[model samples]
Target: MITLQDLRKVYATRSGEVVALDGISLEIPQGQIHGIVGQSGAGKSTLIRCLTALERPTTGSVVVDGAEVSVLSETQLRRARRRIGMVFQHVNLFEARTAAANIAYPLAVAGVPRAERATRVAELLDLVGLGGRGDAYPAQLSGGQKQRVGIARALATEPAVLLCDEPTSALDSATTRQILRLIRDVRDRLGITVVIITHETSVVREVCDAATLLADGRIVESGPLADVVTRPGSKLSQALVPVPDVGVADQRTLVQVSAGGAQAQIAHALYAIATEPDAHVVAGAIETLGGVRVGRWHLDVPDGDRAAVLGRLRAAGLAVEEDVA
Candidate 1:
């Protein structure tokens, strides 16, 4: 539903030109929730701006739902933007407007009839789990409710793609989970493509079907969650399923082991490792991501037994990295 080809964006400042995006190429399929994660200067915001035609790429194309948005004329771009909904981290709602009116604003701008706007706003309110709260103003709503209103407003135009920029960063843990679940529910119901831009890896782990990690204005890692999380020693894998740091008493070598597959397959690997008397798990994490059970562990093993234990793990179909601190 979205495609970016060699996307690059450069900005001119007092010092010199700074490249916010460098050679970014990506594809996100319809109805998929894709996460873009990076630190502040990693070009995530620039990429989103480019995708929305808010910032033109220096020498690349931005395509969404089959339209090359980058080259569209202003008149055309305005129409094109109606098909792309944007949800911001801050719920930038008009303080005086009620939730229903806030959601109706987009439809109003689109020249929707007042009666039709009311019907659509009602449906959206119900869709986002805020049916009776349409009469409430932003000041009267909780943070999560205000965000729900933002989401409903974004969907008011029935966009083909939803661009969520830090959608859950402001919410508490429980509220974040609720919002993430709502995003998934939106995708499942409307089949709309979603691109979530976030700095939090936990957000990616919870909601993204696929993810891209950015660093230094370039893609460091990009793939389906299942594929990336399972690959041993992958940077994205480590970030998403990190093994906690735990100090062991003895001076034994630490080996990192990981595996991804069916529940039984991962369970089998765990059992095999359990049978090794000399190897003790120091830290580990197991999670079901993208329909696969993925496990990563740090094991403390005697130097003399490291080779044998690693060999056995490899033979038993687990990826192992030796002598990791």
Candidate 2:
């Protein structure tokens, strides 16, 4: 339930005017995890700040939960911000405060009662898988634990939308996975809209339903994760997931054979195609995505037998294609 239309944010420096965001228009639907991915200085941070009203956009409109955030006064913007929660990369929790107290801080500021705040904090801790760690201080917790506490604190007020700014950047791979799982769980259970800004494609692949790729202060690509990852074209896509290598050999055809079972089928197919003395397999790899084995095999076959090999693969009920240059 967030929309940005022709949102532009420019900054004045000693050199000249810098366009941090150049006409970025985006829509984040409710109850879905949306990601903004790009390299450093691609306006990812600027976009998030503009959305949160921490930095006002130079032009265009920002509508969040039906309210025009761009036009709201300072006092009104503060009120609007309460409906949006943010989790920073550094897990910005008070060092002296215990986990429960850190979470209670938001409710405390919101004028929530002590008993209700306690209950809410407890529920949040449980939701973030830190139920019994409420008594621990931030110093005693691991990176992942601190982030969970940050998440609990962010959700203390039960905000409708959550903005994560490189939430897993500082954590190790294991910790990153834990934090991503926690974020996914929160989104699924609360139906809260999540907008994650990260440069890591692995993070987006694991958690995001859809993503937008930003470059040179503009959106270069935006689509569903699977479609964007599998289809080649976008520069962002190429940087994110690498395509399988298909070798080039003159006077030979590249035949792709797909089988349902394990590597044995691949070996059998190679054997069947071995009748041609010139047949050779250049590259192969098997990867499981969405619980299916999507294997890619590149074969170098003589020009004469290329059609016949393709015919045999098709007769076996497998998807076959010839690479034509």
Candidate 3:
């Protein structure tokens, strides 16, 4: 539903040119929830802005739902924006307006009829579980409640895609979970493509179907949520589901083992690897990734040939890495 090719954004500063996004290229499929995971100054904010045409890229094409974002005229861009809704981190509600009014504001801007806007607002209020609370003002609502209003407003246009920028960062953990679930519900119910930007690995793990890891305005890694999370030594994997950190000495052998396949059962693999009678797993974890059972283990071999065992594991298509640390 979205495609970015060689997307680059540069900022002119007193010192020199500052590159906020450097050659980012990726695609988000229709009705799928994709995450752009990064830390502050990693270009997530800039990238999201570019996606919405809020910040025009220094170069490259930005296309959403078959419309070229870069080529859109002022009026064309305004129309294109209706097909893409945005939910901000701050909720960005009118302080003086009631929740229902805030949600109706978008329809109002679009010149929706009063009767139709009223019906849509009522439906959205119930959709976000804010039913009668729509009459309440933003100041009277909780943080989570306010965000729900923001979401309802974003959906007012019946957008094909929803761009959420740090939608849950300001909320508590429990509230974060609630918001994620709500986003998921929105996607399923509306069949809308969602692109969420977040710094929290847990958020990606919880809600994202696929994810891209951003660092210094570039994508360090991008793939299926499970593939990226279970990849050993990958930045995104390290952040989400990290292997046990083994304190290694030059003399001691610390071998990290990993394997993945839908057909290869973890139980069978555990029973099959018995190359050494004394070899035992010191640290390990087994989890479901992309509906497949995948595992990683840290093995400590004393008085044994570590290289031999590692070679055997690798020969069997398993990833075995020597922990130099």
- Using Cα atoms with residue i matched to residue i, what is each candidate's TM-score against the true structure? 0.95, 0.79, 0.92
Itemize residue pairs with steric clashes in candidate 2. Answer: none
How many residue pairs clash (N, CA or C atoms closer than 3 angstroms) in each of the candidate models, in the order given? 0, 0, 0
Better of 1 and 2 by TM-score: 1
Q: Mind giving the per-residue lDDT tens digits that candidate 3 earns over 152-256?
A: 999999999999999999999999999999999999999999999999988888888899999999999998866774565666765666567756444457777
- Residue 37 in candidate 2, Cα distance off native in Å: 0.9
TM-score of 3: 0.92
Write model 2 residue lDDT over 1-325, tens digit each, in one string.
9999999999999999999999989998998898899999999999999989999999999998888998899989877888899999998999999999999998998889999998899899999998899999999999999999999898888888999999999999999999999999999999999999999988887788888999989999987665554442345445554346776767777765544344565466555545545557677655433222334456677788777767765665455556623
Scored by CA lDDT, what does every candidate get?
A: 0.93, 0.81, 0.86
Off by over 4 Å in 1: 248-251
Ranking by lDDT: 1, 3, 2
lDDT of 3: 0.86
Which structure among the candidates has the greatest lDDT?
1
> Which regions of candidate 2 fall more than 4 Å away from where they truly are?
244-325
Model 1 Cα lDDT, one tens digit per residue, 109-146: 89999999999999999999999999999999999999
Query: Which candidate's TM-score is highest?
Result: 1
Better of 1 and 2 by lDDT: 1
